[model samples]
Structure formats: structure tokens, C-alpha cells
Target: KKKVMADTNVFLDRLLNYDKENMKESTVEKMQPYIKDKNFRPEQVKQVSSALVGLCQWVIAIEKFYRVNKVVKPKKETLGIADAEFNAAMADLNVKKAELKAVDDRLALLQQTLDESNTKKQNLEDEFSNTEKKLTRATKLMAGLGGEKSRYTMQSESLGEVYSRILGDVVLSAGMIAYLGPFTSNYRQELTEGWQSLCKKDNIPGSERYVMANFMGDPVK
Candidate 1:
């Protein structure tokens, strides 16, 4: 309101100055030509001049007010709009930063999980390698054991064959002794010599030596 009043004062001052500068020459000189023919009355000319001055003053007041105040308002409104846009842009940036942080966190978790999986895979591979090595050694040991078993089996069979031959020889010799001893006492020396020779040829221990050591001093029964 104070500024409006100040502009009104300035407008009134301009109007008065304009009227003063033209008071001598413009108003009267312009009216003189028409006044000579009495086409305009004195009272009517005064009213017209007053109306024109008032109209010009009013127009100047309005135009000055518009020029002065025009500089003050739109800049504030544009600044407000700019501030709003800046705040919105900042908010969007903050949201994007939060989203990026979340993505980084998720990526970190995934990397950790992948590292754990790789460690587990490496452990499993090592275990499998160790198992394979153990299995190979076990297979080799089994093969060696099978060879030993086969050799032992062959030795056992050879022993069995030798035992069977020795048993047969003993039975035959015992039968010969039983049949010859009672009826051929005079031929005993000759028969013992022949038995010794047979034992030597067969690569067997002498049964005659055992018999003489144990049974010669005892009854047959």
C-alpha cells in the first residue's frame, strides 16, 4: 500500500510537471485556432483539458506500478519452482543410492556363497582323490594276497600228494612184514637188507630203525 501511494505521488508530480512545461504554449496555442471561430466554449475547453490530464495521469500511475512490481514477483515464483524440482531430483538420487547399496549387499552375499561352494567343491575333490588312491592301494594289496593264496594252495596240494604216496608205501611195507616175518625167520636178515635198499631208493626214512629201537625189545602185541 505504501508503494502504491508512492507511485501515485510520482504520477501526480509528473502530471503537474507536464502541465507546467506546456502551460504557456501547448494548451492555449492548441485552443486558440479553434477559439477564434468560437467553435469551443471556455468552460467546455477547461473541462476537456482537465479530463485529458487526469486520464494521462491515471495511465502513467498504472504503467509505473506494473513496471516496478513486475521485477519482484515472478523471480520468487520461478525460484520456488526451481527449489521444488531440485528437491525432487535430490530425492530420486537418494533412492537410487539406496538401491545401489542394496544391490551391492546382494552381490556380496552371492560372492560369499560362491566362495563357500568353491571351497566345498575343492574339499570334495580332495576327498575323492584320497579315496581313489586308497582304493588303488587296496586293489594292489588284494592282488598280492591272491598271489600268495594261490602259491600256498599249490604248496598244500604238493604236500597232500607226498603224504598220499608215503602212506601207500607204509601200508605196502607193513603188509610185506606181516606176511614174511613168521614163516621166514631164516630170511629176516636178507629181507631187512632189501627193505633198507628200497627205503634209500624211495628217499624215505628207515622203518627198520624205528622198529628195532622200539618193538625189538617188546612183544608184538
Candidate 2:
């Protein structure tokens, strides 16, 4: 825009110089029509010619000044119309610039809001993912603990059955020992022989035979 203004000023300067050069010659030619008297003395003619020349110069100067200042007359209404239209165009451009600035501001605000929303959404997604992972870990832990509990219950039931059998055997052996007198070694031997015969009938192993002997003697006592 500045370059255009500089170029326009240069052109106007050249045009004004051209017009000034032509104005003096054209003005003198136009004034010659009014000067029809050829009877004047040499001195008077020179003086009147000089005066007419001055008047012509003044007229050209006034015209140049009027052109330079862009004085609008009734005969040249186009100048006024052109000036009005240029002013209207400039006003419209200002309004358009203001509207464009407002739109830019609105866009900036919306973009900021969108960015904040995205950040919140990302945080929520991260939190949900973390919660999901924690829940999965807890589920696995519970499942593992349940397996351990089930195994313990089964083991306890098996142990309880074995203890019940051992307790019954001990009680039966205690009754037998109490019935058989301590002084009757012969009768105790006979009882051992009878238990051995019963073991053989039941198909008991020789390695387990001492278990019955220990139960009858040590456990009973």
C-alpha cells in the first residue's frame, strides 16, 4: 500500500509539471481574442501586452491551484460523486475488518475450549483404564485365594478323618489293656497272637504289624 501511494505521488508530480508548462502558452493564446486593438503606441502596446501576460499567468495559476486542491464545482459533479463513493467503500472495508477480527476471536475461544475438553477426556480415559487394570488384578487375587481355601478345606477333611480313626483305635486299645491285668503276661501274649491272627485274616502287611503292636502297648498305656 505504501509503494502504491509513493508511485501515485510521483505520477502526480510529473503531471503537475507538464500542466504548468502548457498553462502559460495556452492562457496567452486564449487572451489574444480579446486584444483586437492594433492602433496602440509601441510603449503602451508593450505595457498592455505585459499586463495581459501577467493576467494570463494569474489565471493559469488559479486553475492549477483549483485542480491541485480538487475544488468541486457544480459543472464537475462527478468529482463529488467519486469522493462520496470512495468514502463509502472505505467505511465498508472498516466494517468488514471488524467482523473478521470478531470471527477470529470466536474461533480462538472455541479452539481453547475444545483443547480443554480433550484433555479432560484423556484424563477420564486414563482413570478408567487404571480402574479396569486394578479390578482385573483384584479378580485374579480373589480367584487365587479361593483356590487355596478350597485346597485347605479338602486337606482338613482328610486330616480329620485320619484323626478320628486314630482316636477310635486308641480308645479300643485302652479298653482292652484295662480289661487285661498288668500281672497277666501270659494273657497279653495270647492277646497279641490273636491280633496277629486277625491281621493275617484281614490281609495286613508285615511292615504295618508293628503299628498294631505299638497301638496296643504304648498308646494304650
For every model shown, what is its TM-score relative to the native structure? Answer: 0.41, 0.44
Which residue pairs collide in model 2, if any?
none
**Cand. 2 TM to true fold:** 0.44
Instruction: Write model 1 residue lDDT over 125-188, tens digit each, in one string.
Output: 9999999999999999999999999999999997676564554346445755676667565576
lDDT of 2 by residue, 1-221 (tens): 45743686685565456554334546556645544335333445457686445444544455555555454444357767888998999999999999999999999999999999999999999999999999999999999999999999999997676564564455435545677566576776577556656655665433223244654456656
| Model 1: residues with Cα > 4 Å off, grouped in runs | 1-73, 156-221
Q: What's the residue-level lDDT of 42 in candidate 2?
A: 42
Clashing pairs in 1: none
Where model 2 places Cα greater than 4 Å from the true spot, the runs are 1-32, 35-53, 59-79, 152-221
Residue 124's lDDT within candidate 2 is 100
